[model samples]
Target: MNKLQIKYIRQMLGLSQQELGHLIGVHNSLISKIETGTANLQPKTEQAIITLFSEKGISDNDATVINALLEKRKAV
Candidate 1:
């Protein structure tokens, strides 16, 4: 996921960065860094996020729709 998508999904799920980090077994600072685009999402981290989405019943199509909305919002 891109930074914007990550941020959007977290917000949609009403999760703070710390909460997501805890769920994904990562440091909160890493989550911050990711959202800020200063760090890359590691393979394991991405997988964890995907797993989390699966558990939450958030499909890739949902993510795609969010991405499109975000891009459209940016255009606005």
Candidate 2:
């Protein structure tokens, strides 16, 4: 997942980094680094994130678009 996607999904889920990290089996610091675009996530982590979005009725394409929108919001 891209940084934008990660940040948006976490926000949409109403989850703090520690909460998200607990759900995904990662450290809170790792989640922070990822959201900050300072970390490259492993493929397995990406797959898990994708699955989570899919369960939330977010298609892969929609996820991408949402990520783009979130990035635009961050830029503004």
Candidate 3:
């Protein structure tokens, strides 16, 4: 997912960066770095985020968009 989508999903889930970080097994600052384009998410972390969004019932279309953005980011 793109940085904006990560932040958006976190907010939608009513989670602080700290909370999300805990769930994903990262420090809160890593979340901030990820959201700000200063860090890259490992594949496992990406899957965790996808699972989180899936559990929240994010639409298939939205998930597609997020995955597309992730692929694009990797290309960069």
Candidate 4:
């Protein structure tokens, strides 16, 4: 995922970088780096996030859906 997507998802989940890192077994700074575009999101971490969300019944699709709705509003 891109930096924007990561940040957006974190905010949508009401999680701080440290909290997400702790849950996913990474250092918080790594999450900061990923969110700032200083580092790429490693595949394992992405999978971990996906797994965590699945276990929590959180769908990433919600972000896309919200963005689409917002775009439609902008068009009016």
**Top model number, lDDT:** 1
| Per-model lDDT | 0.90, 0.82, 0.84, 0.79
Model 3 score (lDDT):
0.84
Which residue pairs show backbone clashes in model 1? none
lDDT (Cα, 0-100) at 3 in candidate 4: 64
Error of 1 at 53 (Å): 1.7
Tens digit of per-residue lDDT, candidate 1, span 1-76: 7889989899889889999999999999999999999999998998898789768777999988889999999999
| TM value for model 3 | 0.75
Using TM-score, give the best candidate's number: 1
Q: After superposition, how far is residue 58 of candidate 1 from its true place, in Å?
A: 1.1
How good is model 2 by TM-score?
0.80
Q: Which residue pairs in model 4 clash with each other? A: none
lDDT of candidate 3 at residue 21, scale 0 to 100: 91
Cα lDDT tens digits, model 3, 1-76, are 6677888778878999999999878899999999999999778888888787788788668866766876788799
Clashes of each: 0, 0, 0, 0
- State every prediction's TM-score relative to the real structure: 0.93, 0.80, 0.75, 0.74
> Candidate 2 at residue 4, lDDT?
78
Candidates sorted by TM-score, best first: 1, 2, 3, 4
- Where model 3 places Cα greater than 4 Å from the true spot, the runs are 64-76
